[model samples]
Target: MKGFVKNYSGIIWLLTGIALGSIAGLIFGKKVEVLKPIGDIFLNLLFTAVIPLVFFAISSAIANIKPSDKLSRMMGFTAIVFLATVLISAILTIVAVKIFPIHEALGNAQLSEKIEDSPFAEQLTKLFTTTEFYELLSRKSMLAMIIFSIMIGFAALKAGKAADQFVGFLHSGNEVFKGVFILIMKAGPIGLGAYFAYQVGVFGPQLFGTYAKSLGLYYGFGAFYFVVMFSVYAFVAGGIKGIRRYWKNNLIPSATAVGTCSSIAVIPSNLDAAKKMGIPEYIANVTIPLGATLHKDGSSISSIVKMAVVFALFGKGFDTADAIVLALGMTVLVSVVEGGIPNGGYVGELLFISAYGLPIEALPPAMIIGTLVDPMATLLNATGDTVASMVVTRFTEGRQWIDKAI
Candidate 1:
């Protein structure tokens, strides 16, 4: 009974924080403007941990696996799952926009003028062709960080006994970053409360429903994607019962991700659940953490859906070729690049808006609607990670390679 109460307390606190924040925002939204700073602080804390965490975690995980044959296989499997997920998401976004257009009734406000002032196009161009060091320390780019970490890790592994001290240092750094992540996440209720209040104060409850419908459509499509993909994993690896069991064990982690709207905060629980479900520890360690950092089916999908909404609102009819290309490219690139960054959805959406030279006035509306849609996006991301893991596990056939000390 005591344990049950303790477990329930976390959920209660999360709900209470959300409620209080919303109420506060509704009452003093325009005057106080307190939520943005608090949210920013929260984001800062998250970003501080991202770089070191990615560097250490990826280095350590890759260093432990041997023979290098399985490495190629794992990379291939991950790439396929990542691309497939993005494609499905793009198709869903296109269909949703066609069927239940969001921007149909919005007021006509010229957005091109606003788009010209923003830095999104420039940022996108920079991302396509930047040196590793420039991207890592200067731009703080996620793709750059992953590439640098992987290269160093591979080097460390190849160095034999000489790299032992350096590998130990990375492992220690990973531990420290993980500890910091926990400390920050414990304050989640407060952050959620403050942000929610600000949102309600600024937008009111009526806007909630409108945003919710768009979010609902995205999640509905995401659910379809998850089911279909998991069915394939089941057919390939285990049967229906195995898949069902996997889902049963994963429910807690999934629900936590949905409620918190944070895959980073849910990582420990996800790792634990993966192990309990009989996923090999090596696979779980390598894939789950890597997936959390790289696989973002939800954010990629939501970016496209939101872009469609923006177009509809502006009365700009979709260009079939551009829309298809944007949806597919944005989903994959954003999923891969933005996955490691904190506030990934926020950053990804801003980048998307800027990249396409969308109007700035639309940003406020996008921010409001985007925040509302985030939890669903987080849910999709968490589910995508699970599906990716299952696929990788199957592809690898649960084979265990001996870990060699560098």
Candidate 2:
């Protein structure tokens, strides 16, 4: 039993969490509200490590660049690919919402207070600030910290031995936090199960049916998108055989993405899959690390779903040209800042309430859609990250290069 668990702890924990949460939710129904604390505790624990996690993760990735020239080229190509996917995903998401058409009526506003309005210029500036150095610990301003960390990483490249020592320390901390993250995940089944249970208890399985249509539409679109995009890219990079090989090797990473619902959490598994698929170390390393945060195609699609759902629930329409642009802009913004935010699930809520000027009542539904689509979103994002590396390797090196067994 010990050997079995030691070998399959991740798989075991994931299945257990799902089963427990589902059972609990069904047994207690709305009474599962009592389990809220258990879920919240898990969320809080994840939150506590996020600050250190972001700082070290980003900085370490940047600090490893041996030559600035290579860094620039890799970043330029990866960024172009990442941006293209995000832009296209956002456009498609809008189209999907239009095709499906959520017709739910608006409910009363949930919260009375509003975020103090800021000029659009100020909001853009807030995305990367020079001030509020201390607030990063509490995640009051993550965008600023991301900016700061990047600057630090670039500076470390030129600062010589002292900088190397500092970055080494940072990398060490990054590894420690990664280990901490995995440790926390050991409790995932308990935490997420309870969280899901609380959700089920409050809303009941019947309630999911109300959301299943709109959310289901998004998932269906995601499946179609994945099959088409990944199949094309995989075949382009490695041929028909390559396509089969990529999927065969990708099972572990895909499951991890769904189970953990975290891009960073699945990094190790993704890295292993990349090696199995025979992508070069240079391409895989840089792309996967940066892509995890910046390449959020899933979030882009989810943001569209979020805005579309929120607008419908708020009695607004995506009818006018202005409404369409607002949806596009909000989708892009939410997806971009998502990786930078702590407990980024609130990202949709923050943008809708503050930027789009939707009433607070839209928040609950936004939150609901976020929870429902997250696993799929993460799965798409993770898969995209791997495929990106494959494409990059094929471009930089050659074609039909990977093994099917992998």
Most lDDT-accurate candidate: 2
The C-alpha RMSD in Å for every predicted model, in order, reads 7.4, 6.7
Summarize candidate 2's per-residue lDDT along 1-406 as a digit string, tens digits: 5654554465456557756786788887888888878877866776576567767766776787676676677667777777777888888777777777754432332123333434556655654564655765654455566667788788887786778788898789778877776677667678777776876666556434546676887899899878887787788778887788688888999888876777887789989998888887778888887778777778888777777666655556556676666566656556655663443655445544445556434544565566667778889888788887777776666554565324
Minimal lDDT window, size 10, model 2: 105-114
RMSD of 1: 7.4
The pairs that clash in candidate 1 are: 21-197, 22-197, 25-197, 25-201, 26-201, 103-313, 160-406
- Model 2 — TM-score against the truth? 0.63
Candidate 1 lDDT score at position 354 = 42
Candidate 1 lDDT, 95-166, residue by residue in tens? 776787655543333233222222445545454445545557432355455566778889988987899898
Each candidate's lDDT (Cα)?
0.63, 0.69
Off by over 4 Å in 1: 1-15, 34-36, 68-82, 103-124, 128-135, 138-140, 203-206, 226-406
- Best model per TM-score: 2
